[model samples]
Target: MKRTLLAASLALLTGSAFAGTTLDLGYKAHTSSTKDDNGGAYDQPFVKITHFNKADWGTLLAYLKLENPGEIADAQHGKDGKLTVKNLMIIDKQIGDSAYNWWLQNFLVSNRTVMEDNLYLGLTTNRKFDKLFINAGAGLNYSAAHFDPTGASFDGISGGAVVINAIYPMQAFNLKHRLSVNYEGQFARDDEHKSTLGYDSYGHQIITTLKTSLTDTVYTKLHLTHFDSWGSSPNDGIEYGVAIGFNF
Candidate 1:
């Protein structure tokens, strides 16, 4: 299923250098099949707003995300790792048609009224060749968790995927489409109240999307995302969603 989706998406990037600003709002519902028995089929609704435009100074881009958990068995499922919001800021410099972008992101996750914040910094260089576009970059992240007990907290530092993304836009099967893929593997360290919980953690994710314009201002996207986190503790992932969006 994953490979089929990826191949179909790549088929869209044939020969293009068109760029524009886009905004997306959507939700995904999936069944979880992790090693842990604590998992359940959950429908997560998300609202995302993104802005990207070319400016005299550079190309500026920004995004805001909000996620809601519809149901849960555990409070962690109900309220844990719930109530999350993230924001990203990006600046890009163009040389010819290709560009280099630097970005920073802030993430907040709330569980049972306890909130945690994480920050990440990243840099990427991208090139557009005819109908194919590629991007690569690496980033570092730091996370701080706050607890209500007044004396318990967790902190962590991690390096995230220096990844490559290839996109192909509109040109096959009489349907306009766009396909994108990316990967990441990183090492992490965690400390609680300055005490080591573990010194090993790693994560990886892959997402493939297919999009077509229904009209001049409206588009639809079929996306499938799979993620894995393995090491001392692991978080396996699942996501599949069909989203309809409007573009300006």
Candidate 2:
């Protein structure tokens, strides 16, 4: 299933609409516990990658993250650290001369050797404010089955969600700064899977990141997250971290 999804993603990304790419290598710190490999809550170490590009059809956004890198065999990783992969992809296609844009979003998360995936399809609108750009949408969510930490399963058709994401950039003093916000949450749910997700569900998870760079290649980032949950897991907290990396 994973391979098939990846192949399909590659095919969709393959086209003449090639654009620029940015790469960064850095570590993240979480101030609070988050969903982990076993469908439980814990503080984990991670390396994150974010990519954005323009395609003939629309725009593509991909985020790849490796959680609890085995090399850090500490409390976060336990004695035998396990590496996990969490990914998200969004394809935004503008409607023909319409004010709305079609949105297709996919979430793939691998934990305890089991892979969990979800899909969201909806319509969004883009707006600009001086230096900030915003995209907001509403959609339906479908979730696949996955085992929780207790080896129990949670799966089914989750319902309607609304998302609001934005980005802003500016120059302060002698450095360049970029601020971005990502948020998505379900306002409706399917009773059968209302408590499916391991963390931050029913409510929403919002991440706000600010990257300050002295040069084109050197930068520091401050990332903050707010997870408001009203589900089985019940996680409500704020997390802040910093990362230093290169942007090229």
Candidate 3:
């Protein structure tokens, strides 16, 4: 089922990008990592891809990082280690040609892998400065489900916190530079499920990456992710990884 959903999303992305699109494919391997909190026993490295465009409709960006092939096959559905799949999209289409932009965001795997099976529907804006492009959105967040890969799972909701995502690509910073920051907060949720299954009331995750081009078609990415599930101990940590990649 998960595989089917992923396939459908890729199809939608391809369809939407038919006219003006850029596709970059690459393989990344984890080289080093460190953190402030307890790290997971198993690693879930991934191949990350991204796309962004502003059109007559509005603006949108899509990102997907499929877990490493060896890790995914070895995960064994939680027996050996927890598996994680990272993918997200943020689109802000113009409202009747008005200056204000409004649209729905997308669902994504939480950095902690829980309390985040949700989407944001609200206002978005696009801005550019120098060589950087940014598309940001903030709105009422509807958490469609709660998934704790550690065992707990349910349908839940977040009482609307600001979800912000942006990208900064520097094509002439000596070396091509790629940077993006994504943040999602869990300020409030349906009280009925709050604190259930050891879940907490507030949480957030900061995912940042800087990819420096190694050559015309090669690069390295510094992945730094801070995850806090309010007070969840094991899931609250700073995850990091260094990767070498090639453009395809």
Candidate 4:
């Protein structure tokens, strides 16, 4: 009896391992309504690649994404124009059949021109019940922002986020749509120890996207976003974009 039970347990574990490995690659492009704020968003594109494999201890997740952003300049919004690099990873395991989840991510972002880098580590998980899926996670990010305005240099700000997401499927079109929202805030305190230029800033970002299938491997998407900041000198704004995507 004891031998039979042990054999059954091993078989179940082996089967679960084979069920969870997946690989995917995707690309997206966006064009802004006005070329003034940001250069002609004509070829603005982002590419992502991801892989997940079951491991002896847990799951191994790896991903990489790169973006060539157009120049964005507005007197009130500051100046943003640089190539960006982003990397992410996650590893987690199954607790029970219904609650198999992972321990968030190890992520990094870098600005090529300024030589500034930002890093973040966090935990994320998802749960499914019936036809509904719920997911949430949070993490802290640290990075330095240099004020290369010729006379002063300031470097002291931390970023963090809170997220909530859900998805439902409609039987009619055999489509599954997901809705996710995340609130991210950043705070910076002058570390230069200069009182005259000493300043702190806070800001929040919110995003929403809708996705549906157009064919067996084709898909469509719509995105909306809002960002607001408040402090000594602050700016707030909103933006929306829509596009169709293909999977190959």
Candidate 5:
């Protein structure tokens, strides 16, 4: 099922109907510290690819993330670790000439042993005031979890979230940069196994990116991201990462 979905997404991405397309490849290294482990830090490295398209009516996006590509095993190998593969698909459609839009998003997370899937349907709005851009959304989410290795099954749960994002562009030190802030809060029923599972989560992140144009079709981006998440036992952490992106 996962492979079929991936194939379908790629097929759509390669279709010629889209008016514009952008592809970005990036590498990021992250370290996370948790509260329970005496603030032990875990290292995670990710390779990501993002495909964005502008269609006649709206926009489509597909993102793929591979965490710990080197498969480094240490203290962060199990419940406290990150997923090995994460895939996201998003569609945004404009509502006439209004400032509001409709969006559908799906996410699949897997570690070759366990998998989690989430679907979101929502409304979003984006506005620009002078040099600042603000975007916000509210959504409903349906999530499911599965353990492939053990063939364990669990009931799916429903949730909701509110998300906000802001971006500001600036010129300083003879360079152009963008600062972005994002916050999201998800509320869901506590899982049946509350001691071992968590569903409600909140995250906040700030990113600073420096963009440099290398050519007409190529560009470089260096960015630093600081992120924090809470509301779930053993799932709360602070993470920081640096990444470099190449756009074509």
Candidate 6:
């Protein structure tokens, strides 16, 4: 079932790529501070691809992130350093001429041993005033986790979250700049175990991105992100990176 889902996702991406697509490659380094003050840092390389049709069918986006490449980690998880791979897919459809839009997104994360998947469905609204643009969205998120080890009592766990995102964009120094904020409150109740996971948990993230033209088809990007979480799972992190990209 997992293989079939992956294949279908790849097919959709391939079909969209044949239309008009933009690709971005970048690297980022981040550090996390856990509740116990045991902090660690890692480097990540990421790729983003976006595609849209001229007939306004919708937009498709694919993003992949690799963490701790080359095994350069500041800390370790058990005997090995932390390493993770994550992929995100998003689809957006407009609601006629109104300011509303519908979106569906999926996220998959793996740590070579365990895998977690999340699905989200939401609605968004956009408003533009002069050179400034604002977008806000609310969504429902469902997540499941799988463990690789056999004989584990935790066959699978499921959870849900209320997710919100907002974006503000403007021109600065003749460059494109944007600030984005996201929040998620998650909860889960397991009947078999008579327990709850991520109960009363919440996370907030803030990101700022600046882009400037390096050439007619090339651009330079600077980005900074801060994340915080609390409740059953408490963690905080920050990431800063710069990348050079081109449009085709």
- TM-score for each of the candidates: 0.68, 0.78, 0.66, 0.54, 0.70, 0.65
lDDT (tens digit, per residue) of candidate 5 on 89-150: 87878688666779788888777555667677899886777767676888987766666655
Ranking of candidates on TM-score, top first: 2, 5, 1, 3, 6, 4
TM-score (C-alpha) between model 6 and the true structure: 0.65
Worst 10 residues of 6 by lDDT: 1-10
Against the hidden true structure, what lDDT does model 6 obtain? Answer: 0.53
> Which lDDT values do the candidates have, in the order given?
0.55, 0.64, 0.56, 0.45, 0.57, 0.53
| Quality of model 4 by C-alpha lDDT | 0.45
Clashes of each: 7, 0, 0, 1, 0, 0
Given candidate 6, what's the lDDT at residue 241? 84
Mark the regions of model 1 whose C-alpha exceeds 4 Å error after superposition.
1-25, 35-41, 69-83, 93-116, 146-152, 190-200, 230-234
Candidate 3 Cα misplacement greater than 4 A, ranges: 1-41, 72-79, 96-99, 110-116, 129-132, 146-153, 169-173, 230-235, 245-248
**Candidate 1 per-residue lDDT over residues 1-248, each given as its tens digit:** 21222232343233222234455667775544632422422456667776654444345557776656343223325644354555655554544544666745455655443455656677777676886777666778776766554546677674454566777776576666777675545545353522322224656567788777665566778888776642112356667887776665
What's the CA error at residue 67 for candidate 6, in Å?
3.2
Question: 1 or 4, which is superior by lDDT?
Answer: 1
Off by over 4 Å in 5: 1-32, 35-41, 72-83, 147-152, 193-196, 200-234
Off by over 4 Å in 2: 1-18, 32-39, 71-81, 113-115, 198-201, 230-233
Task: Pull out the clashing pairs in model 5.
Answer: none
In the predicted model 4, the residue pairs found to clash are: 104-124
Residue-wise lDDT of candidate 4 within 105-191, one digit each (tens)?
Answer: 555555533223334445556665665555556666555443333344434435554445555443345664444454445445234
Best by lDDT: 2
Q: Give the per-residue lDDT digits (tens) of candidate 6, residues 27-91.
A: 77665443243233445565655443323555566766666655555443544555677787866
